[model samples]
Target chain A: MKFIHTSDWHIGRQLHNQSLLEDQRHVLTQIVELAKSNEVDAVVIAGDIYDRSVPPANAVALLDEVVNQLVNELGIKVIMIAGNHDGHERLGFASRQMQQSGLYIIGPLTSHIEPIVLQGKQGGAAFYPLPYAEPATVRHLYDCAASTHEEAMIALLEAVTAHDSQGLPKVVIGHCFLDGGSESESERPLSIGGADKISPSLFKDFDYTALGHLHGPQYKGQEHTRYSGSILKYSFSEQKQKKSVTLVEFDADNKPQISLLPLTAMRDVRIVDGALDELLAAAENDANRDDYLMVRLSDKHAILDAMGKLRSVYPNVLHLERTGLMASNEQLGIRADHIKKGELEMFADFFSQVSGEPLTQAQQQMMVDTIDALHKSEDNQ
Target chain B: MKFIHTSDWHIGRQLHNQSLLEDQRHVLTQIVELAKSNEVDAVVIAGDIYDRSVPPANAVALLDEVVNQLVNELGIKVIMIAGNHDGHERLGFASRQMQQSGLYIIGPLTSHIEPIVLQGKQGGAAFYPLPYAEPATVRHLYDCAASTHEEAMIALLEAVTAHDSQGLPKVVIGHCFLDGGSESESERPLSIGGADKISPSLFKDFDYTALGHLHGPQYKGQEHTRYSGSILKYSFSEQKQKKSVTLVEFDADNKPQISLLPLTAMRDVRIVDGALDELLAAAENDANRDDYLMVRLSDKHAILDAMGKLRSVYPNVLHLERTGLMASNEQLGIRADHIKKGELEMFADFFSQVSGEPLTQAQQQMMVDTIDALHKSEDNQ
Candidate 1:
């Protein structure tokens, strides 16, 4: 059976307060198109269907549209699990009824992990979905002394494997921070430092393990075990990483062949560093104008309305940094004695630094008058 | 065709900082049982499925369980609409796929309201679900001059009737405030004052109109047009209102025979008023001990630890009021001369009134010392 393996959709996520709903819609539409063209039997979404437990209305709508297209329009089966970012109960709501139409949503882990078996021309493959659950819950549920995530995962896998002695060409889907997997800023830390990391060796028995939670498209230990990564670059730290969905095809023997298909964003996130004039010149090129950009200026002085000027040329510029000014100004730090000075003197110093010029005579007089009136009012009170 | 009509579920609602989830669960379970025993063809949930747009996880889970039982287990059809309290897009998510399994959920209103026709042993009945939508949206959607909800309803009904020239038996499900309908504190006002009030004349053509939005189960102008009310008492104002689900059975001619089946709450809300001693004597009977009680004490004197004392007899006392004290205190208002007095003098007056005794000489000295220390601290600042 051939299927599109994807996870970490993180719908309703925002980058620097900018909504990515349109971007999410664009990519999800492409996924639906890819599914239709490839004629995949099923789509496996491992976890993190939403960025938060209670997502905004638009995010919910986008998810509805995509699921409707894939399950109703394309007539393909969808198997999904709740990730750490999701509210397990909320995501799992109405899932039983929904599954009647070929949408399988598994929520919080239970002692009895049911496998959803899918039949193909050659044979049937049983899919074991292990949604993200806390170690304490697992320990209590299984009546075991699993104190860590790895221990909990191992116990769960052993339980499922023991029940499925017939094998039936099994595949496991999970959401975890595997040991040796790369990290990104947007991915919430699963545990303190490396304590929560689980080695990929535990899944050696499975033909293939599709994973989520780490927002980078790469392998942990083996070629068959992979993270499809987030569909979008969720943070500026992920600026250099390529985002993609993993496509896994099963052979006659149930062994898997995996491939990565890159996803093109509606607007790419780019960080450009140069002098103000150089950045403006670069923005003149139409190719750079539309990308969501964070520009760092290296000029040794504060530019007047730098963000406004940059936005005029680069319409999608989200952030602006005066690196050169900050670095130089760090040396000329405010002295404790300066804080003890009168309000007018402090205002004059701040005005000079920001405008790159001394305050005018009229401006200085206005500042003094304002300060005097304020003191007079305070005395009256 | 016969169906159980219910609305204003307001799941996840809280009363006096207490969770009513267990109460809601009990009532919903009873509803499911009623559906099975009655063997209804469909269950129509008019609107206000949740108390808030973004409900807590438990509310979502409860809704999921109830819907699963009604549609999957019992094989009954469910028709729901979005109310003002619900997030329309969120509630309507995956509705298209859900409809495949006989669960029809309508969200925002549109120009064309498609009817879901349910054919019974006798004849076919068309159900036109009119979800809650703003007047502006209806006006823009149909391009009509509808400034009020009544006008919008008229325009929408006209549009539906104009399209449905087949003359099939029809029932309209809606969530709106009709004129002359009694309301409670819990039901959110659809619009300011009388502007939102629509008349029962709009549904004169239909055999029956199942309504929601008002928390009282009553008819407006006609018996065929009615509100089923909420299943639970959401506020003290609704304490006297008897809650019920409206059972509508259609005959061979498709005319609805409506009856109200009273719903029993897990814990009843009660309001009791009398002197404190009289209330304690009444509580000695132990008949209404388990009921959630709001007590109003009529004694003119202040009672120390009244709540604590009352709770011993009435364990579920949620609120306590001293109406006699408030009435008498209004006449003995705060004097302007008291404002000029020292803090210690003001404290003495307050202490005397509450304790019904003057402060001891030692207590007065302590008050003086404390006030002196507070003044010194303020001077230091």
Candidate 2:
């Protein structure tokens, strides 16, 4: 059976406050075209279909159009699951009804994990979907003493193994932060204290493991277990990463062969570094000047209306940085001190910067009370 | 063929700032039970499944639960449409897939109207669902010059008739304001200046018309053309209404028989008019003290903390009005003059009353500019 593994579409995400709907639609169309040309048996979406729980109206429409083309127009089966960013119940609405048309949506963690089996000429593959759930939820659901992401994952894998009675190749689709996977700025923290990290050894028994929640396409330890990465470059930190969907094909012996198919975006997200005058002169001959760009100027002086000047030539320039100014000792000292502050102090500084005022004594006390309450709740869980 | 007709669920609505989700759930459970006991072939919901376009998460979950019970549990077909209150694209998500499970959700005004045919021993009934569309939408869809609700209905009905080629008993499910149907405070006006009113004669060709948007269960002008009313009383103005679902059955001759099944609410909304002291004394013997009550105090003298006192006895007392104070000639004069004021003047007064300050000259200018822009847009439409 040949299937495409994709995740983290983030359909309504914005780039530097600019709407990415148009760019998202362009790339999604390319995905649909690829699905049609590949003539794959099914498409497995790991998780994070939208950037937020309640997406905008146009985002909903875009998803509808894409799914309609995939299921109704192309006659392909689509298996999807909800991630941490999704409203589980909302995403799961009319799921049972949708199953009749070969669209499977797994939302809200349940006691039982059902495997969706797809048969092909070679054989059948049982695909188990483990949607994103908190460590507390995992503990309560399985009635276990698991307190960390690794323990919760171990508990969940045992449940999946209990249901793996069918003698077929198994594929596990999950959304979590796996150990050894590279991180990106756009990926949200799954848990406090960095406890949401699971090892890839738990999935050694499965033929293939498709993962999400990270923005780069990379395998944890083996090529069979990997992250297909996000559908787009969500942040500047991912500028050099090549985004692609993982295609898996199982042989007659149930051994899986993997291939990464690259996707071309409507406009690339790139970083341009040079002096102001030199960068402007380079932009004159730059063919991809319309790409989303972040400019880094190396000049030793301040420039007036630098952003406006760059935007005139490179229309989508989102950010401008002065490496020359940041080379000063005072700026370096501020950056150095940033790493030494506690979480509360860092939050207070962030609050002051955003609100243009210092946190009041009452507000600081309220934050302390909230942190205490959160700790108590975690302890109870 | 037998089917239960219901509409205007307005899920997640609140009464006087109090949540009505519990009451809504109680009534919806009753509707599902009636569907099960009656062994109906299908349930047709005309429109307004939600109170607003973007419903809360709980509201979406409630709808999901009800739909799952009916379609998955009872094996009954559900035909629903989007009204003005629904986000069309959001409500229609997965509709194509849902059709395989006998759940038809019609949203957005398309050029073509498809008939959902359900079979029975006597014959089959082709249900034509005309979801709520603005006058401009109707004109654009059918390429007609429809400027009013009556004209829009005429155009839509003509399109529906063109698709009635199966020679089956035709049933039309629509969401619109008819000419002779009574209106409640909860029913939003379909159009400005009463241009949204359509006559019952438009559906004379159909066998039965299950209408919605009017919260009262009554036939408009003919016995066959009727409204199923809402699942519950949404406003105090509907205090006297007997909320129910309309059951329609077709005989061997393809004729229709209609029956209204009454639904008992968890807590009735009622008005208690009398002196505050007498009302308080009477509450001692009232077994239904928890019922939502609106106290109309007829006391000649000023009462201290009348609302707080009433709430002690009737815990759900939502409103308190001093009828004696309102009987003054000065109050009557103010009320009489309200009708003579212009729209802009009334809006200004309302703004001042709510904000406790008069509109500034600049604000008045902005309002004038907005009104001008609105009028221009309407003219173009």
Candidate 3:
């Protein structure tokens, strides 16, 4: 059976105090379009549908509509689970009724050991939707059993296997930081206030593990266990990473074939560093200059006029920084411009009239000296 | 068509430091059960499905389950809209598809003035799922020359009437507060913060205004316009009020027959005040006394003995206060048990222990003498 796997939509979110609703919407529309075109059997959203446990109303509405479209319009069945960032009880509410419809939402905390059998035309498979379970909760829930985060997770899988009478292929959907998955700063911290760490080996029993929480389309290995990534880029750091949903095909034997569904953002993020003239020269011929640029110019002294100079070229530039360093002469093909006699003196004379904190004589000389150094560096290159 | 109307489910929420996930689950489940038993044609969640724009994954999962159940299991159609506390684009992601699956979710900023047509068992009605729109947005969306929240809302409805061809009865589900609906602190703040304060007359064009955002179940002078209130009270002050879902029966004229479906808390919350003895005297008789209790005792003379006295009866006593009068009045029964005594000794003992400065004997005597005089009045009362 072939199914599209997507996780971590994180709808209705904010970053840098600016709302990402528009951005999230832009991407989700694309995902739905992708799903429709792909013609997959069903969709499995592993976890983290929202950024926070208490999502805003609009976020809820967004999911409501999206699911409605998928189930009603597209005629797709969706199986979703709650994550650690979710309030388990809240997610499980009205689940019984929902399941009776084609929406298979698994939010059972204690019943994680049991699998929801997906009976289909091709064959059948059991889906175990494990929200988040803490070790303490497991011990209390399972008669004071020895419980660790990893152990509790394994214990639940064991339960799933125990109940696998139909012997169908099994899929486990979850939200966790595996023992080896790489994480960025934007991901939720799960150190448990310095208490526990989860091991990926705990999930060895399942034929496939569709993970959430991490916003990257990569894997601990190359197959079976993978992150579909968030619906949106979410942060400046993530601007360049390829975001994609995963499609997994599980055979009767539970072996799987996986493919990536690439998602591209409307804007590209590019960073550049150089001095005033050199930076301008490079950007002038640059193909993607209109991309959302994070230009980090290595111009000695502050560039108060930098924004204005760059804005005309890269109007959508989101950031500008002046880091002190020599421009890369080889990369820019910057030629040393000739300095006419007394040009510095003329410029200094003009500068004196612009404002009240006029540069001291020594400061004026420093400017000329800096220009000479720039010229000398260009000559060497 | 008789149906359950609920709104402002800020799932994945916290009230103060307390988690409301369990409460949300309990209440939402009750609403679904109520709808199933009553056999309503549809469930209208006016707006604010989540507390914040980014609901936690759990909230999303639960909502998916509940909504799925309402449609699939209970055979009830769910028609929802966006509210002020939402990011519309995200919530309405799959609205188009949801419509095909027998669920109608009106999300985001829409200029389509025509109300959604609902063919109920009792004939048909025009269901206008009006999302909350800002004045500027409304002007832009409908190209309506209107300003102010009320004007914008009215303009949208007028446009609805002008464009709608479904002439059966008409009902409008909206997120607005009338002049009379009391505001809960957890609600989006009033006009100053962009929360729309609109009169029910804007909805006079329709049979029923199923409102959201306000956390109280109420109806304005127009019997047809009702606020379903929030699914759960989100603050300490809301403890006294019962949270409920409104049931509305719409006729051919689109007028409503409204009733409140009372919701009970899984755990009871109570605040009690008294001296140690009076509190313990009542605790033994209180049925749910062992439930979560916030005890405030006005006891005099450091009641070091109080914790030991109360711990036996109350398992989760969060707050404890000690006032001088209460500690001194730990007598059995006979409230206002006037015979006051030993004020000077109590004052002398307390001051002697707490103060850093070595107070003189005369000073201590003066302080005690003052307290004794105050106790004299209590002795009489």
Candidate 4:
């Protein structure tokens, strides 16, 4: 059995208040194309299908179109689980009815965990979806004493595996912060107080485990346990990470072979640092001019209209910073003596530091008069 | 051909900050039971499936459950349209694919309007759904110069009728504020100004019209044109309005016979007016004690713990209004001359009006000192 593993679509995500819908749509289309060319039997989406609990209308429509294309057009089965960011009930709506059409969606944690069995040419494989759930919810639903994410997950896995009498190979799909997995800025903390991390040993009995919530594609201690990662660079910290989906195939004996398939984004994210003239010169010969960019200038003096000038050449410039100005601003911080002074005196000291001049005699007199008038108005009230 | 007509579900609606999900679920279950018992060929929901554009997760799940029972279990076709409150794109997502399972949901205005033709024991009927669309949207979609709701309806009807060549009976489903239709507070205004009101004469060509957007069920001059009203009394203004679903049966000749089927809400809404003692006495013999009630008291003096005392008898009391105290408070309105006085003097007069006393010398001195301290703090800033 061959399947494509992907997760964390975050369809309605925005970077620095800019909509990434078009970029998302472009990449999802590539994913669909990849599935068709590869002729995979089924697709598995681990979790976090949406960026927030309540996605915008456009995001809903995009998911609808993509799902329709996958299940109805390509005639392939899709198994999806709800992640921490999703409203489980909303994501699971109409899931039972959709199952007849090869679209399986698991939502909130239930007492009984059912594995969707898919038949292959050689034999069959069972895919168990353990959706994200709070430890309290799991404990109450299953009548257990699990107090943390790791304990809840272990209890859930044990319950499902105990009921499985079939000798078919088993694959577990989950959304959590595994113990040895690396982290990224875009991924939200699964739980406060660091109780969300789980060890890879819990899934040792399974043939493979496809994980989500970590934004980098890597394995834990076991090669069979992997994070498919996000389909896009969701944050600046993920600029260097290679985004990809995992393709898994089961042999005749149900042994797994894994490969990473790279995804090409609509625009690459780049960070550039140089002086103003040097940066402009570098931008002239850049191949991917439309890529989103963050530029840092090393010039000692202020450059007016720097962002405006850079945007003309690189239309997608997202951020611009001046190292020299930052260093100067650090020096302008008020001293201990200045903090003890009155508000007027502190203002005078800060203004002089920024302008490289002291307050004029006329300006000092105007400030004194303004403060006195303010005092008179306050006294009348 | 027989069909049940209903609309203005407002599934996620809340009354007095109280969640009405249980009430909504109870009524929807009754609706499903009615559909099954009647053995109706199809069920038509005119519009307003949700109270807000983005319904909460539970609302989505509720709708999904009801639709599944109606379409998949009962084996009846459901035709739905988007109302002003619904997010058109989100409501209409996956609608085309769902059509295969006998669920039809129409959304935004389009040039081509296709009718869902259902075959019955006697004959076939074509149900045309005209979902809610703003006048500007209709004008742009059809490339017509329609500045008013009436003009937009006429243009849309013309476009649909121009393409209808089959000699089948036509039933039009619409969600708009029809002229001469009464409304309640719960029903959102269909449009700003007075442009949303459209004449019933526009649907004269159709055999029958199932309308929505009004909380009252009534015919508009013609017997064939009707608003089925909401299944629940959504507001106090609709206290006297009988809530019901319209059951329409067409004979072999395509003639229509319509009857109103009254719906029994789990908890009815009522208003009672009397003195405190009278209200307490009347609450004793009330057969529907669990019903939602709003009380208006005629007590001449301020009553301490009035709400608490009333709730002891009527646990579901939603509102409490004091008519006698209101009359006294009206006489205490600030005088124009008092507005010219200082803030402290105005405050003294307001306090004296409510308490029927003047500030003591000690209190006045304390007020002055407090104001002086506040002024000193402002001066320091």
Regions more than 4 Å wrong, model 4: A119-124, A162-168, A324-381, B119-124, B162-168, B325-381
TM values, all candidates:
0.84, 0.89, 0.58, 0.82
Worst 10 residues of 2 chain B by lDDT: B372-381
In candidate 2, how many Å is residue B66 off? 1.0
Full candidate order by lDDT, most accurate first: 2, 1, 4, 3
Shift in Å, residue A348, candidate 2: 6.5
**What is the C-alpha lDDT profile of model 3 across B249-343, one tens digit per residue?**
77655567778889876666556777788888887788877554556776655666576678778755655555445434454222222212233
Candidate 1 i-RMS (Å)?
12.7
DockQ of 2: 0.49
TM-score of chain B of each: 0.83, 0.88, 0.76, 0.85
lDDT at residue A115 of model 3 (Cα atoms): 65
- Categorize the docking of model 2: acceptable
Clashing pairs in 2: none
Interface RMSD per candidate: 12.7, 6.3, 16.4, 12.2
List the pairs of residues colliding in candidate 4.
Answer: none
DockQ-based ranking, best first? 2, 1, 4, 3
Q: lDDT tens string, model 4, A162-186?
A: 7573877788999998997888778
| Candidate 2: segments with Cα more than 4 A from true spot | A300-302, A325-345, A348-381, B300-304, B325-381
> Can you write out model 2's per-residue Cα lDDT over A12-99, one digit (the tens) per residue?
8999998899999998888888888887888999899988777777888899899999999998889989887777777888898899
Structure candidate 1, residue pairs in collision: none
DockQ of each candidate's interface versus the true one?
0.28, 0.49, 0.12, 0.20
